[model samples]
Each structure stands twice: as structure tokens, then as C-alpha cells.
Target chain A: MLDKALSGSSRYWTWVIALMAIIGIGFVFWVQQMIEGLTITGLSRDVTWGLYIAQLTFFVGVAASAVMVVLPYYLHDYKEFGKLTILGEFLAIPAVIMCMAFVFVDMGQPIRIVNVFLHPSPTSPMFWDTVALFGYLVLNVVIAYVTFGAEKKGIAPPKWIKPIIILSIPWAVSIHTVTAFLYSGLPGRGFWLTAIMAPRFLASAFAGGPAILILLVLLVRKLTKFDPGLKPIFKLAEIVTYAMLVNVFFVLMEIFTVFYSQIPGHMDHFTFLYVGLDGNTTLVPWMWTSTILAAVALFLLLVPKLRRNEKVLPVACGSVIVSIWIDKGLGLMTGGFVPTPTHHVVSYVPTLPEIMITLMVYGVGALILTVLYKIAITEREIIEQVK
Target chain B: MAKSTRRGFLKLAGVAAVGMGAKPVYDAFARRSAPEQPTPPAEALTAKRWAMVVDTRKCLREHGCTDCITTCHLVHNVPDFGNPKDEVKWVWKEQFEHGFPEQHNEFMSDDLRHKDVLLLCNHCDNPPCVRVCPTQATWKREADGIVMMDMHRCIGCRYCMAACPYGSRSFNWRDPRTHIAKIDEGFPTRTRGVVEKCNFCAERLVRGEIPACVEACKAKALAFGDLEDPESEVRDLLSRHFNIRRKPGLGTQPEVYYIV
Candidate 1:
């Protein structure tokens, strides 16, 4: 099946080569970061975590979103998702890889990552997050391999894989829950210290992940011989709509609790993120943009006619991804850090090297996605030709 | 032939895994078998639970005094990055409001409100930093309540930094070797990508000497002693003075106390 990826048109090769070039440049900067330590990034004493951690948080949601498709298809016997389930799993492969990569890049001592396993502390949420992510990655890889292989052979997947697929459903939820636990369970950081964190994470993940999948599937339709019918795409759009609505509702709940109660500890972070705390207003514009985009996305997705419109559907999905990306990936991390534990407001902006390294991680994800997607499409094309 | 070869390979792999696994098991057994160093040497300052009491009245008596911070940094070989962003602090001076954000008093005495209070690691009984450290790189000492950091073992994830409600821990964001004015020959300087903070001078206490900051303070603002010993100075200060712990509401049970 990998051989299918090796033979592609000039256009496919151009995209693949472009991703490789970006990856190469990013790798060079990563080596520089290792040499300079975390000082090369925007991370400081007050704002300890920045871009890498935010990206890791966002991608964890994206990786866990694979269950959205997997659960519906495997458990409910949703025939519409039968052709699309593999796409979801394959999308997860790169997303998880990107998640893991973001973690690796974020570490101050990347070489010492083995310490987490060698001297594991079960009490730590990070330890559990690492375990959950690794397990989720393996589950997806095995399921995708076995099921896709069976499809290629024109036979059913082996009986042994059923239990693994069932196990993956709960396992997917665990990964994002553990990731949320990393932030939410901390003694300080009022922005993250909420019971709603894990639920909010899942809601945004379900919204953002499938939204990304819709865009990818649309791209696949245009580029490949395989046309994953409108039924699954529209179904995914509906999921994105509801998830986005819930995500917005969760944010509103948080806002109401924070503003109405007027707890300075909790309100300070929200104020710092949405408005400016003290004189620091760097994140104000970005936060408002994300808020506006979320509103725009919700409006487009909620209207049935607009959602069904081919052009509008992609726009809504794109808005959802970008909005949630900024909300979770940028705002969430900074909000937790700023108005530091001591009430000092410090702003963080990712340096050139840091942003480059981030782009590089995305490039690696795109490259893996392109190859895996190429193989899936090629197999579908072969099946279509046979029919 | 294939089946026999496959079985042989599995057997080889099993043997290799056992060989790799034996050292840690042996090390664990060796540790359990060895005599425990349960008691400190007679000359050493032993503590059942270590604690510190900072007299802010005495601490900020002199204008712009940084004796404690200066002595601590010099003794610990803590680098002066000259910039706040990459600054590594062991002990530092912060205003009363900033030091204890939870104790927000708008109409406090002008002198108390304006004065700089000394802040360092509280070494909490229920230390969130220790609990959150994935590698067990940081832990609360069994004999003493001191939260210890094994810089060598830390992967520098900074989970401890976020978890520390007091903003005590500092990550070596850049190579610290470049910035230190003079190396403290006795102390081990840390590499970049590791977290470091005041260890309550555990090294000095083991050598029968008090913490450098406590020793250097002319005003006698900082008192360190065994909290378990009722006769100790820290106990005496706590009994006499109206003392408060930072963020007492969080239930971290900070060993460090402050007298306003």
C-alpha cells in the first residue's frame, strides 16, 4: 500500500517536496533551540509554557477526534462512515504524531524525556497524558492497518481487532482528559482550574477535528479519483455544528461564572485574555478575532440551508478550525500563565525560531498525512476501477 | 525451520530483556539491604520538619537591602541573567502585596504596603510541584518537609513551575554558566533545561552550618530551625508573633511563615 504513495503526479510530489523543505528548515532551528535552551523561544519565568504546549494541547484534541468517526461506524454500524472511517483514523495518525512532536519540541531538555518513563510518577498528570497518548497512537495505527489491509484484500477485518476497536473508544476520551488534567489539576492558574476543562476540550476537539477532516475530505474529492459521497461530509458538518455550539456554550458558562461571581483570581485571567490586564493588551486583538470567528462559524453552521451549501460548508469548517485553534492553541495557554501566580502580567510572543519550529511540526504532520492519504485514495481508486 | 528459528529468536529476545532488566532489580535490592542513614551526624542540624519565619518588619527596616538575595545567589552559584525574562532566582525581594497576593489589604499601613518582603520556596507539606513532577525529579523529603529537586533527573517540562502557587521555582532557560560572575567552587552549578530553587540550604544544614541568607542577615529577619522542636527559634517566633503563611487557603501547608 505504501508503494501507492511512491507513485504520484507532479502536483502531489510538489506538495510533498514543499512540506519536506519546511521540515528541513524547522529541524535546523530545533537543533539551534536545543543548543540555546528554551531561551530561543518566547518562554519566560512568568509565562513558562507558550507555543509548543498550546500546539500540543490543540493536536491532542484533533487526535482524540478520530473516535468521532470510529465510534459511529464501529458501534452504531453507520454505513455512511464505512468509507470515511479510514480517513478519520489516518488523519489521527499525523495529528498524534504532531501532538507528540510538539511535546518533544516544548521540552527544555528534550534528551531527558526518557526520565518520564524510566522514573515514572503515577501521581503526575503529565505521566498519565504521555501514557494515554502513546496508547491512543498505537490503537489507531493497529486498527487502521488491520482494517485497511482487510479492505485492500477485499475481505473483512480479523475477529481479534474488534476488541481493540471497542477499547479505542474510551481510550480516545482518556487522552484528552489526561491532557486537560495536566492544566486543570494545577493548584494555581485559575483559567485552567475548572471542572469544565475536559468537557470543553472534547467539545472543541469534536468541532475542530471533524472540521479539519471535512476540509481534507473536500481536498481529497477534488484531487483524487475517490469521491467520498456528500452524505458523510454533510454528516460530519452536522457534528461540527453541534460540537461548535456546545463549545461556545461551555465558554459562555465559564464567562458567566467568572464575571457574575467576580472572583479576582479567576476573572483576572479572563480579563487578561479578552481585554488587557494592567497595560498589557497584546492578546486583546487575537482573542477578539477568535471570538468573532467562533460567532461567524456558529452562525454559518447552525443554519441548515447555509450548512448544506457546498461553498458555505467549507467556509464554516475553516472558521471553526481557525477559531478553536486560536482559542485553545493561543489563548488557553497564555491565559493560564499571564497575571502570573504573583499577580504580575507578562505577555509572551513566540520568536521566529519558535514559530518556524511550530510550522515544521505541522509540515511533518502534513507530509505524513499526504502519504497515508495517498495510499487510502489509491486503494479506493483501485476498488472503484474493479467495480 | 521457520517456526524453530522464530522460537529461537523469541528466546534470545527474552534473555536480552532479562539481562537489561537485572541491573535495576539488583540496585533496588542493594538499596533495601544497605543500612539507612536515618540519623544525621551529631554536628549536623537535624530536623524532623524544617521551617522558616521571616520578620518583614526587620527584613525591610533598611531601604533597598538585598543582603539575603545577594548571599543566596552567590552561595548557590545562581547566575544573574541581568534580564527579568531569563532571571534565575533562589531568594528574591518582592513587595508585600506581590508576595502574598491572596492577602490583599487595600488600606494597610503605608510602610507595610510599600516595603519589600523576602520570598523563597515555602517547601510546602503538600507541595503541588512535587506531586506534579512526572519524573519524581522533585519530592518532599521524608525526614524533613523540604521539597528537594534532583536537577539531573528533571526533563525540564516546567510542570512544577505552573503547579507552584507561590511562583518559587525557576527554570534555567539559558545556559547559566555564561552569566555567573564567579563560580562557587563548593556548589554544583546547574545546566540549562533544569529547574532550581532554594533547597532551604539542605547542603549547609548537613554540614552543621545555617543557610547562607540566614547567616548573612544583619537585622536577624530570617529564622530557620526544626519545627518539630518546640524550643527551636522558628517555633518561638511563631508562638510570639502574629505570623501568616502565603495562600493559606490553598491548603499547601507551607513550612515558611511571615510576620507582618
Candidate 2:
């Protein structure tokens, strides 16, 4: 089965070699990070967390997005998603793995990650986040393996696995919710202290995550002979639309509250991001670009004619992903730190080493996903042959 | 058993009698309803929740109090960056305007030009860092109410660093071992990419020693003591002089008090 799948790609080795080279480059950068410390990163006291954490935040959403297709197909009995759901599940395995890796690289001591379990503090949101992330990873991997094994046998998945599938729908939501709690629970950073943070995170995750997945499905269809039906893709796009609307609404609500009360604590962060505060104007362009992209993406997605068009659909999805990446990933983390308690502006830029390590982490995730997808595709081909 | 030592036997009997007599009294106190007596004055308590009072008014920015920062960093094995970008400061001096933006008034002195005040972790009564830390790596000690970071448990997500409004937390983006070769071998160097900050010298506190910064203060501008104890030196200082906390409007209720 594996050999059959390998035969389908004449240039498979070339792709593998290229991925290996990228991974190797990333390894050298990791060594640099270990030796030089985070000083090699653009982070400073003002922006203590930068690209690594931002990417982690973004990918957690991607992992959760797997549920958009998984729930409808597995639980709702949406047969249109039958062929595509496996891809989503397989994609989640590597996405979650990357989520964990991003977090690992962000840590000062990755080995001490075990201390979270050893001496757990239930009261801390960080503890709950760890629990949720690890739990979700376990669930996704277990469910994927079980489903794949059943598929290889040309049989319905075991009765016991149905409950796991149902449980995963909520678990997917929990992972992103807990990740948001890691931010919103903070008391001093007024920007992150909002009650709506967790919900907004979920909304944004549902939006950007599914959009990326839709784009991925198109890529898979183009590259591979496997054709997941267009109906499921359309439905997923609809889900992305609603999620994006909620995300945009929640952001507007934040803006309204900030402007309505005119409270310095709430308004200061917005001022720093959109308008310069104390003459510091670094994030203004980024914020404006995100705002405009979000608007354009929403406009394109809301129109049925535009959203249905293949060319327009990918563009809309890509725009939303980039917009949310900026809004939640870069803007959210950095904006929260601006106008520091001292009302001083401190900037964070990802240094070359930090960027390289980030690229390496991404490559690692892609490599894992590529291997997993290859195996699943081979197994499907074997089942087809047996039939 | 050999000689039936009378002194030893008597001592045991005396201890048993004291234990027996004290049992009912202890039980009675435990079983009794709440006392009707008024609460004791805040100052009379001995086990004071520790706090720091920074006299920003006396902060010269001529680098007078910088010795405190340097000594504390040296003692804690905090990394020294020859460049500002790489600097991971547990304590440092910030210009007066940067330190007290909300407190700016026209009446303030021109002599205060370029005046800087020593800044470190505020160790808030309701620290966001403590609340956000997922691994329980950062915690507020119940004994003295000081916010501390346990580096061993920290996953270095920088959540606490991002959560802190004061910018007091620092991340060790690279191995801090290189910079700490001169420090005492007892203090451990931090790994790359973990968040670290002033722990109030928790080790020194256990040894009944003052934080290195307090001991090194040239102008006697920094004070540390139990805030919960009304009679503690910090409380006394607070009462004797007007003081402000960094970002009080945020309502973190910082234990670090600055007198201007």
C-alpha cells in the first residue's frame, strides 16, 4: 500500500529532501537559540513573547478547526464529508503536534514541561491549558488511528469509538477556550482582561482555522487524485462565514466598549495599536492592514456569488487567515504589552534566529502531516484494490 | 532500664503533664465560638506580609541606586547583556517620567531632570502573572505574599511576562549560563526561552537575610518588610511618608510602594 502511494508521486523524494534540508537549517537555528538564548529573538521587556507564541496561538486554532468537518461527518451523519473527514483528522494530528512543538520551543526549559503534571496547580489557567492541549492531542490521535484502522478493514468504526467522536467536538472547543484563558485570566494587562476573550478566541479559531483547511483541501485535490466533494467544502465555507461574522462582531464590540467608556486602561492598548501612543507608532500599519483585510474578506465571503467562485473562495479564505493571524497572533500579544504600566512604548521584532526556528517548527509540522497523509492515502488505495 | 535514671524519668513525666494539661485548653479554643474581642491593630502582628517601599523622590538617576540593581542581579544569577536588546533585568532604573507618567505635574522640579527611579517586580497583592501562569511556575507565596517564579516549572511561554503590566518579567531567550560565571556557584543559571524576574531573593529570605538590593541601596531608598504586620518597617515607612504604587488604577494592589 505504501509503495503504491509512493509510485503516485514521481518527485516524492525531491520534496522529502527539500523538507529535510529546511528541517536541518531549522536545527542549526535551534542550536543557536540554545547557545545564544532568546536574545537572538526580537523580544524585549516590552514585547516578551513574539513569533513563536503567536504561531502557537494561531496553530491551536487550526487544530481546533479540524472539528468543523469531523463533527458534521462523524456525529451529524453528513455523508458528503465522508471522504474529507479523514484528511481533516490527519491534518489535526500534525497541527496539534506542531502546537505542542511551538510551545516547547517557546519555553526556557522544555524538559520542565513535566513539572506541570508533577506539581499541578489547578487554580492556574496555564495548568488547565496544558491539560486541555495534551488531552485534545491524545483524543485526536486515538480517534484518527481507530477510524483509520476500521476504514482499512472496510468496516464501520467500532461502537465504542462513536462516543469518542462525540466527545471530541466539545474537546476541540475546550482546547482553544483554554488557550484563550491563558491570556484573559491575566489581571494587569487590561487588553487581555476582557470577559469576551475566550469566546472571541473560539470564534476567530472557527473562522481562520476552517478557512485554512478549506484552502488545504483544495491543495490536496489539486495535487492528489482524491477528490473530496465540493458540497462539503461549500458547507465548511458557510461555517467559516458565520464564525468570521461572529469574530468580527466581537472585535467591534471590544472597540465599542473601549470607545464608549473612554477608560484609559481599555483605550490605551487600542490607541497604541491603531493610533500612536506617546509617539510610538510601530503597530499602526499592521493593525490597519489587518482591519482592512478582515473587512475585505468578510465582504467577499458574505456574497454567495463571490464565495462560490473557486478563485474568489481561496482568496477570501486566505485573506481571513492572514487577517486573523495578525489580529489574534501578532496584534493581540504585542498590543497587550504596549503602553506598558509606565506608559512607555517598547517594541518587539522577531530576530533572524527566532524567525528561522519558527520556520523550522513549521517545516517539522508539515513533514509530520505529509507522512501521516501518505500513510492514510496508501491504506485507502489498498482497500480500494481489495474491493 | 539499667539504673532508672530519676532526672530523665522526671523530665518525661513533666512533658507528659504539660501535654495533658494543654490538650483540653487547645481543644476548648478549637471548639469555642468566635471571640467577641475587637481585632488587634494591624501593626501588632509579627508575621507581616512583606512589602517594598521605594522612595522615588530621593532617586537621583545619577546611578546612585543602580548598585542595588547590580548586586541583586549578580546574587540571583541574572544575565548581563552588554547590549540593551539582550538585557534581562530583574531590577533596573527607569527615568522618572517613564516611571510616573500619570503622576506628572507642572509643579514638579526641573532639578528632577532625567531623574530615574529603580524598577522591579511590583509583587502585586493580586498579581496577573500569578493568575496566568499555567504550570504553577509563577506563584504568590502565602507565607509572605511575595510573587515568585519557580524557573524549574516554567515552560517559558512568556504568558506571565505578557500578562504583567509593569514589564517587570524578563525572558531568558538564550542560555544565561554564560553571563553568570562570576556569580556564586550556588545560584543556578536559567535556560533559554524561560521567563524569570525578581523573586524577592526567596533564598535569602529563608536564611533571614535581606534581599541583596536592600543591602546594597546607597541612598537607603528601598525598603522591604511585612505589609500584613502593622508594626513592620514597611508599614511604618508608609505611614510616615506619602507613597504611590505603579499603575494603582489597574487595581493590582502592588506590595511595592513608591514614595515621591
Candidate 3:
């Protein structure tokens, strides 16, 4: 399988090289952050978490999205998705890796990462997040490897893989739930302290995560001799549209509750995000862009003509990814800190090093993803495309 | 990297999430069964529970005295970073509205509303920072209830800072040693990345001394003593004045009392 990764076209090799170059640059910037401390980033006492934690939260959603394909195929016996499940599973591998990597770069003491395992406190939500995420990563790796190995050797996946597949269903739910618990469990952060936070995370994950998988499968179909079929792609698009509608509905519910209740603590974060607190609307433009993009994405996905058209479907998927990316990636983690513990409205803007470190992690994810998909595609050649 | 039979690997994974999760899950349950927190060292147990009461009337806010702030910061090796964004303050004055947003009112008496009240770690009986720490890097001592930080153990997660409702915790944003104008020889300077806060002068308390802030108070506003002891100065002061704890409704049981 790895040998297959090595045997790529010049174009593929060029892409791999570009990602490698970025990984190197990212390493240097990470080292600089280490030497200089977290002060190199725009993070302050008020906005403690900045870009890295936001990326961690976003990728957790991506990792959980793999369950969408796994659920329909394994539980419901959706045969069109039979060939597509592995594609989704493989996508999760790099996403989880990047999730942990983002945490590594964000840490003030990356050296003490061993302390998490050295003294694991089950009482802590973060400890459970580690367990859930690491567990899911290993589950995906084993499931994808064993199943793909079986297919390569021209045999059925062993009977034991069935129950493990079932276990993955709940395990996938836990990953994002635990991530949400990181914020939701905190006492004073009104922005995140809501019962609906876990559901909101899962809803957005289902929407944006599968949309990304659809894009990847489509790319693989165009680039390789394999075609996972149009039927599965359309079905995935349908799941995304429904989940995205739920995600937007959930956000609206949150907005209605906050604005209606008129609780100052609850309203403080939204005001800071959307309108800026005390005339310091630092995030107002970014928040508005995300809101508008989400609406445009919902419009593109909801319209039957635009959704059904293969040309326009990819654009809708991109919008889903971008819109959710901004919502979760830009505002979600940092926004909670506004109206800080002391009720101050200081803002955070990720410095260049922080942005570079973020881009570097993405590059690392891309490289891992390229290799994994290449291995899977080589085995999956000559698949029949359903009408 | 070694190949195993698919069945063998699947067996291991089921064991991994549930089997490995067994001890910690059970330990969590066991810890829940016990009402008390992990016991502190024997020395802490010998001392009566320490607490403080600050009388705003005697704090000399009108004179703009920073004696308590300067004494504490200098002794604890707190840096003088000119950058407010990266400031590392253990104790400082914050306005009433910012410090007590839950008690916000549009109009109030000028003295109580306008003055910058001294703020520090409340050292709550139910410390949220202690509960949320993953590495047990921070914990409330069972004896005196001083929330202590094991700086070596902290991974710079800053989750404690988020959990603390009072904004009591501060991270060393830079190599804090670099910003210290003159590093105090006695106190160990904190390495960058770990969280730090007022340990209620736990070291000084151990040496049969009061907190630096209490000692440096020219107005005799800061009173430190065992809250458990009826004869203690803080207890006597709290009995006389209708003092309040910040965000008392949160039920953190903040030991620091303020007499407005």
C-alpha cells in the first residue's frame, strides 16, 4: 500500500513536495514559538486560546463525519456506500492526526504532553477527549487497514470487524461530544455553557464533514480509474443538506434564546462577536461573513436544481466547509473568552506565526491524506459506478 | 507495523476502549464515593484553615496606595511587563463593575461604584480551577484550602484559567524572567507557559508569617487569620461588618471577604 503511495504521477509528486516544504516551514515557526513562548501569538491574558484550539475543535468535527458513511452502510445495509465507507474512514486518519497536532503546537509546554498520560484524571473532560480522539484514530486506522487489506487479498473482512464497526458508531459520537464538553462544562463562559452544544457540534460535523468526503471521493474519481458511483455521492449530498439545515436551525435557536432571554452574561458573547463590545467590533466583519456564507450555502444546498447539478454541488460543498470553518474555526473557541472572566472585552488576532503554524498542520494533514487515498484508490480500481 | 490476524486486532480494540477504560472509570467512581478531597501534606493539616478579610474603608483607595500590590509582586518575583496584554499580575485593583458584573447596577453610590477594589484569588472552598485540572497540576489542599499549583506538572493547558470565574489565574505569556526588572533572589521565577496565581503566600504562612499584602497594608485594611477560629482577627472583622464575597451566589465559597 505504501509502495503504491510512492508510485504517483509527477503532478502527485509535486503536490507531495509542496506539502513537505510547508511541513518544514511550519516546524521552524513552531520552534520559534517555543523559544519565544506563546506571546509570539496574538493570544493575551483575556483571550487565552486563539487559532490552534479553534483548529482542534474544527478537525474534531471532520473526524466524526466519517461515521455518516459508516452508519448508513453497516447499520442500514446501504450497498451503494459499500465502496465509499473506506474513503470516509481514511479521511478521518489525517483529520484526527491534525486535531492532536494542533493541540501540540498550541501548548505552552509541548514537552510535558507526556503528563496527560502520566497522570490521567478521568474526572477531566480533556482527559476523556484524549481517550475518545485517540481511540477513534486507532479504530479508523485498524478498520481501514484490515478491510482494505482484505479487499486487496480478494477476501471478506473477518467476522470480528462487524462488532468493531458497530462500536465505532458510538465512538464517533463521543469524539465531538467530548470536544464540546471541553467548553460546555466550563462554568462562566455563557457562550459555550448550553445543553445544546454537543448536539450543535454533531450537527455541524455531519454537514461539513461528509461534504468534504464527497469532494474527496469526486476528486479521486476524476484523478484515478476508480469511480465510487454517482448514487453514493448524491446520497451523501442529501445527508449534508439535511444536516446543514439542522445545524443552521440549531444556531438560530441559540440566537433566539439568547436575544429573547436578554440575560447580560449570555448576550455578552454574541454582541462581542457580531457587534463588538464597547465599540471594539474586532470580529464583527468576520462574524457577518460567516453568517452570510452560511445562508448562501444553505440556499445553494436547499435549491433542488443547484444541488442536483454536479457542477454546482461541489460549490455548495465548498461553501458548507468554508461557512462552518469560520463559525467553528474563527469565532467559537476565542469568542467564548470575550467579556473575559473580569468582564473585559479585549480581542485576539492570530499573528503571522500562528497562521503559519495553522497552515503547516493543514499541510501535514494533506500529505497524510494524499498517501492514504492513493493506497485505497489503487486497490479500489475497476469498481462499477452505479447510475 | 507488524501484521496481525484481523480477528486478533479487533479483539484488542474492544479491550482498549472498555478494558483500558475500566480502571480509570472505576477510580473515578471510587473517588466520587469519598466526600473529602485528596489530603494535603502533614504540615498543612497542623495549621488552622487560613482566610482573609479586606475592609474597603481602611484600604486607602482615595490615597491611591499600591503598597500591598508592590510588596506582593516584588516578593513573589511577579514581573513588571509594560505590555498590559502580557501582564502577569498576582494581585491588582480592578473597578467594581468589572470585578462584580453580577452585581452591576446603572447607578450606585460614588465611593463603592467608582473605586478600584483590590482583587486576587478568592481561594474558594469549591475551586473550579482545581477540579478542571487534568494533570492534577493544581489542587486545593484539604488542610487549609489554599489552591496550589505544581508548576512542574502543568502543561500550560490554561483550562484552569477558563474555569476560574474570578479571572484569578494568569499565564506566563512570555519567558516572564525576561520582563522582571530585577529578579528577586529568594523566590523561584516561573518558567513561561505554566499558570500562576496567589497561593495565599503559602510559603510565608508556613514560616509563621502572614501574607506580604497583609503585612504591607499601611491602612491596616488587610486582615489574615484562620477562618475556622472564632478569635482570629478576620473572623472578628467579618462579624462586625456586613462584608461580601465576590459572586457569592456561584457557591464557590470564596474565603476572601470584602467589607464595603
Measured by lDDT, the strongest candidate is 1
Across B210-248, the per-residue lDDT of candidate 3 in tens digits comes to 899999999998998888888888889999999988888
The most accurate candidate by TM-score is: 1
Docking class of 2: acceptable
Give the Å shift of residue A76 in candidate 1.
Answer: 0.5
The CAPRI classification for model 1 reads as: acceptable
Sorting all predicted structures by TM-score, with the top scorer first, yields 1, 3, 2
TM-scores for the candidates: 0.96, 0.86, 0.92
Candidate 2 lDDT tens digits, A278-336: 78888899999999999999999999999998899999999899999999988998888
**Each candidate's DockQ:** 0.48, 0.32, 0.38
List lDDT for all candidates, in order.
0.91, 0.79, 0.87
Q: Which candidate, 1 or 2, would have the higher TM-score against the true structure?
A: 1
TM-score per model for chain B alone? Answer: 0.88, 0.78, 0.82
* Candidate 2 lDDT (Cα, 0 to 1): 0.79
Model 3 quality (TM-score): 0.92
DockQ (0 to 1) for model 2: 0.32
Q: Given candidate 2, what's the lDDT at residue B250?
A: 72
True A-B contacts kept by model 3: 0.69
